[model samples]
Target: MTTQELLDQIRHKRSFLCVGLDVDLRKIPGHLLEEEDPIFAFNKAIIDATHHVAVAYKPNIAFYEAYGIKGWEALRKTIDYLNKNHPDIFTIADAKRGDIGNTSAMYARAFFEDLGFDSVTVAPYMGKDSVEPFLEFEDKHTILLALTSNQGAFDFQTKDSEGRELYKRVLETSREWKNSKNLMYVAGATKAEYLTDIRKIIPDSFLLVPGVGAQGGSLEDVCKYGMTKDIGLLVNSARGIIYASNGKDFASAAREEAEKLQAGMNAIMRQNI
Candidate 1:
């Protein structure tokens, strides 16, 4: 989806909530396991319940890849369902893929053309060539990993090189790449303070922020530091929302959790206006 279209959805829904569909068979309701496609069934239920409150859904590729072919099929079905029913909602393939130019092109096509995701997460360590291929797709976004929520991120991302931190350089350098206007960033909500600096570098860019809820990132803090005039933030809650219950009430429970977050975002947006 185009950025303006996404922003319009946020306004219509009164939310910037991005529900993470990082499903784990071990954690889902046992009753779902009896279904033909357990994963897609679980996802469909959640989407149906929460789509009104959420503007986006991100499916972490690792969760599906671990289950192999069946897992991939489930993912495809989930995206197809979304496109067929809720095309206005942004879809993200949290694959974190980056490689040589040709390989990156293939990865881009796999997500953008084949699976039909509106965006995909990409690692930036491989530099311009690795990411440019993904950015080349018009109206599709490439969310590059910047300041991640993981503890190990500090080991390299915040390290000083010359006078600036590595991630700061990543933000600065990426803006100059071809089709850079398509770039968004992954700024972990756990590192909300870092967002103040991040926004200084890319004031208008949308940030795909994870690490809220279960990861202990404060939604209020993220809004304080990360929000832009366009409400440029997609705050994600994975386990906290999806795994809210492991019983038959899973989808209803997930919707309740999502509604809470969306309400919070709605309040923030109201105050901003």
Candidate 2:
């Protein structure tokens, strides 16, 4: 999906919520395990329930990769279903993938062409060449990891390198790469204060913010500090929404949770206006 298409969805839905489909077998309803493909079953239900309230869905690649071949199959099925059923909604392969240029091109094709994800999260630690390959795919996005939600991010990301914070340098440098207009960034919701600085570097770029809800990041703080005139934020909630219930009502439960977040987003947008 292009940026304008995504922005239109957010406007129509009155939301910028990105549901994370980080499915885990043990946490889903036991009844779903009886299905032929339990992970996809869970994801389909969550997507169906929350689709109206959500503008995007991000499936963390690690979750499926851990389950091996079956996981890979389920991942493919999930993306295909989204593309076929709800093409307007942005789909992200939360792969966090980056490698040497040749290998990165293969990874890009795997997600952008084969699986048909609208975007994929990539690590910038490999520098410009590793990321520019993913950016080559037109209208498809490469969301580079800048400052993450984890505690360990400070070890390298915030340190002074060449008289600027490492992440600040990253945001500054990545903008100069090939097809940089296709770039969006992964900025953790927990680091809302840093967003002021982040915005100074890339004021108009969209940010995919995780670490809300279950991670205890304040949604209000994120919007207050990070929101741009274009409402350039995709705040994600995974375990807090999908794992809201483990019974037959799980779908409805997820919907309710998503609705609550969407309502919050709506109110925030209104306040901004």
Candidate 3:
């Protein structure tokens, strides 16, 4: 989806919520395992229950990859379901894929062409060449990992080199690549303080923010600094919403949790406008 289309959805839904489908067989209700494809079954119910409250859906690729071919089938079915039923909802293949230029291009085709995801999370450690191949696709987004919301982020992302943090330099240098306008950065909600400086660098680019809800990052703190005129944030909640309950009422409970976040996002959006 284009930036304008995404912003319009936020206005229409009064939400900037991105529900993360980080599904694990162990964590999901035991009853779902009775189904042929437990992962897709869980995802379908969650999507149906919370579609109105969420503007985006992100399925982390690792969850499916761990299950091998069967898991991949589930991922494809999930994406197909979303595309057929709710095409407007921005779909992300949360595959942190980055490699040599040729391989990167193939990964781009797999997600964007074959699976039909609107965006894919990419690792930028290999620099612009590795990431630019993903950007080559018109209107498709490459969400580069910037300041992540992990304990290990401090190890490399914050390392001082030439008096600037590594992530800061990554953000600055990414802008010089071709089709950078289609780029978004992954700024973890745990790194909310850095949003101020991040906004200074690329104020208009959208940010796919994880680390809220289960990760304990505050939604209010994220919007306080990360938000722009277009509502430049997609705050994700995986475990908090999807795993709200382990019983049969899981879908209902997930809706309730999503509603809570959507309501908060609506308030922030109102204040911004």
Clash count, one per candidate:
0, 0, 0
Ten-residue region with minimum lDDT total, candidate 3: 159-168
Root-mean-square deviation of each candidate, in angstroms? Answer: 0.7, 0.9, 0.8
What tens-digit string does per-residue lDDT give for candidate 2 at 70-98?
99999999998998999999999999999
Q: Which ten residues in a row have the lowest lDDT in candidate 2?
A: 159-168
Which digits, one per residue and each the tens of the lDDT, describe model 1 over residues 116-142?
999999999999999999999999999
lDDT rank, highest first? 1, 2, 3
Q: Per-prediction TM-score, please?
A: 0.99, 0.99, 0.99
Q: Which residue pairs clash within candidate 1? A: none
Q: Best lDDT goes to which candidate?
A: 1
